[model samples]
Target chain A: MADDIKPRLRVPTTAKKGEVIEVKTLITHPMENGQRKDAAGNVISRQIVNALKVTYNDKPVVNVKLDTAVAANPFMSFFVKVEESGTLKFTWTDDDKNSWTAESKIEVA
Target chain B: MNTLLTRRTALAAIASVIATRSALATPEQAKEWLAAQAKGTPTEGKITLKAPEIAENGNAVPITVSVESEMTEKSYVKAIYIAADGNPNPPVATYEFTPLAGKAEVQLRVRLAQTEKLIVVAEMNDGTLYTASREIKVTIGGCGG
Candidate 1:
């Protein structure tokens, strides 16, 4: 019932060759520590997005570890030098062993 | 005798009220929280994330990210994600962009709770995830407060 784990990406739908571009990505998650107590004093189970992998045109680009302290809806921004048209792949994993993926296309004219 | 009984009743009522509220948590409270904070689209390989080796302040620290792409219509950079490890909430911020955003780069201030690795994920126009991280040391407590 929790479909909130969807991946959100901020990408330019278009671009030009030799032009630098900015991109960002985020995911919906609670990053529960398994330490918080419910009103009934029961400890809440831990739930967090733990791993991330990024690829360009199916090539390895970046990989990261999502730790326990990351805030909810983890966000990141950066630049990429585009030489040719290609695809970007972003994947995030949660503690429940669920993984979500998103992609964007660049034209590089 | 009546005064003592009335005081006891008031205390019991207050306790019961607190207990009830705690038990009545909405089924989707956590999910709702996540949705409200969600940002950007996820991409895989068009960007780079750069962070500091050490963070002096747990409350506020600086971070930076860069990407490799051409800004033309055919090829360009897209978005970036910044997340701090060990923070109470973690998902820091998601930055959106367009091809007009020349030089895919962003610098920001963030809050960290303790010493841990910070992750930065970038998404290009074609849908990919590029990532990087650095270990930052937090001297003061930020998350517990």
Candidate 2:
């Protein structure tokens, strides 16, 4: 569960100060919902990315509470105000108690 | 004959309990859930919900919610709720935002059990509620897949 998890992010390279910019993220995960049966007819235990948090310049921008209804690869897009040059940090936590983090930087001119 | 009747009554009771547990929320139930979350706040305009009218695969349906807001210190969107009336879990996801979030917009992927109405509710900083809803037709089921 820990080896294959990967976090991806996209943000503008540069933006005018106080400008609104879009941030997109996608994570490669199986997001097993725990309801499916394997070849042996045993129910698979659920393992999903249940939460995601994004911050810009150390300020929290978006916090999402996900559920089993989310698909295999979770993708999220939101907007943020670039007040200064800083790094955007993204974190994903799964049901297995594993957490992954990724970061991207943006220049506010 | 008396013993048979008693056994039948017990079976009926168990069946009713199982039905209640597995049944999905009806339209009214979903509405009540959203209303309770609103907490007497009036639902007005300023919410835009984008979802495909027809989803080829219910396993991964893309949805976006955007609200008209300046997102300044004085006023901004505090939270957003996504709900689907037909799914086993009516409340899909809830998002929280701060003033640093320039716009009140969020995009995510969700699963639909069948054809149902998806609802988006936005809570403003001043305690106002804005809402938008759309119906999505799912060709293939996604929840159990």
Candidate 3:
């Protein structure tokens, strides 16, 4: 019953024209790599987010590949130059073929 | 009596290896992984990797990587790769960027099995390679806790 996975994002609602801004995103996941054992000494199966994609105004911005070396509850921040008002979409895909998404809009003057 | 003693010694050796096991990736694994991506030996400049000298926890060690890039259609950082020599896997993450990004910088947290060297490599659009690294001392292992 690992249905508590969720995506959260922090993006500024507005920006000056031609201003560079930062976008932060986080997701809740165990990110288990199958190396750790419990009190009973049983190996935990590996489960982690495999990739993350970000698009701005329907154009690709960044593509990230996540591996077992990434910690649990992944958090990432990147820089973007805003030229006009548009929407930013973030998609996170996991090992189980599950994809989660979060979006935000920015108004540029 | 000699046979029994030898068996006991063998078991102890195995146990010691397990207890001291830090990471699955060896030092060479990290190099091989980097070599596979880079066309030649990458020079050590253009990218700045910031990491704690002593990380209290190995599960989430905060790191920030910034590279000098104009982020224009002509010249920009095409991709950045991160890996640790002392992790279960050498390849940690790869970030591909486009001209839309104003800069080539990012911040995130990573898992490290123990005290080891963390490496970051950057590939420019013109096929130039740049890299930087830092050593982090983790008090607790990445998976132990």
Candidate 4:
């Protein structure tokens, strides 16, 4: 794991069968647009998260496409309905061909 | 006699011209942006967008959107759209959510080209529309100043 890259998420370990849970995620990564110029006037080259995918218990939940407009250390918060106890998987991919994945488990009450 | 007539006409024409110019300038180019957003008829009380008054950094400004709902199978927030008035491309981001997703809320960091009003529009499952806007002042050339 890249020390600079941290995935922050909110997931309750336990939930009711039909309970609805809110999930928030923020990743600590420098989303370089690659269009910016350095002190030497050279293009920084885009290093942004191109895509983010989230799955719950091997079931696809949310898929996102990130762009240059996404700021550094991107933060995204949303909701998920918990039908059963399972694992939530989050993955983010960058332009430099790097993929970061994190998983959190939830238990149904 | 002709000189007097010319002078009077000149004065009247200049006055009328100045009056028209002032009338046109009264509506700043910025205010027109807001009117242009609600060009169509939308249902009432559908969306609420909340943002800070001043952003220290133009690069990363936090934005949040919330829709009033129960997140039920029959009623929920369908989609949320965000736009910045003065940015080069106003459409900042678009999010789509389903009933399986309980509450309709999204918090994210966005880049503002400059200080401008950020608008958020939420489309509910029932086809109603609610909108809210907030102005964000972005300090130029700074890191979360």
What is the Å distance of residue B33 in model 2 from its true position?
4.6
- DockQ of candidate 4 relative to the true structure: 0.28
Residue-level lDDT of model 1, residues A1-109, one tens digit each, is 3586778888886778856667688777766656568888888887877777766677655455555445556665555556678988888878777889999998877
Tens digits of per-residue lDDT for model 2, A42-103: 98888889899989877899899887778888999999898899999999998877889999
lDDT of 3 by residue, B24-47 (tens): 648789888988977777899999
Worst 10 residues of 4 chain B by lDDT: B24-33
Please provide, for model 4 over A31-74, each residue's C-alpha lDDT reduced to its tens digit, 9 standing for 90 to 100.
87655678888877667786777788876665666665568888
lDDT score at residue B33, model 4, on the 0-100 scale: 39
- Which of the CAPRI classes, incorrect, acceptable, medium or high, describes model 2? medium
- Ten-residue region with minimum lDDT total, candidate 3 chain B: B16-25
Residue clash pairs of candidate 4: A34-A45, A34-A46, B46-B130, B47-B130
Highest lDDT: give the candidate number.
Answer: 3
Give stretches of model 4 more than 4 Å off: A1-6, B1-44, B125-129, B141-145
- RMSD of each candidate relative to the true structure: 13.6, 5.4, 3.0, 9.8
> What 10-residue stretch in candidate 2 chain B is worst by lDDT?
B20-29
Model 2 misplaced regions, further than 4 Å: B1-22, B25-29, B32-37, B42-44
Which is the winner by lDDT between candidate 1 and candidate 3?
A: 3
TM-score of each: 0.49, 0.86, 0.91, 0.72
lDDT of residue B26 for candidate 3 = 80
Ranking by DockQ: 3, 2, 4, 1
Report DockQ per prediction, comma-separated: 0.10, 0.67, 0.76, 0.28
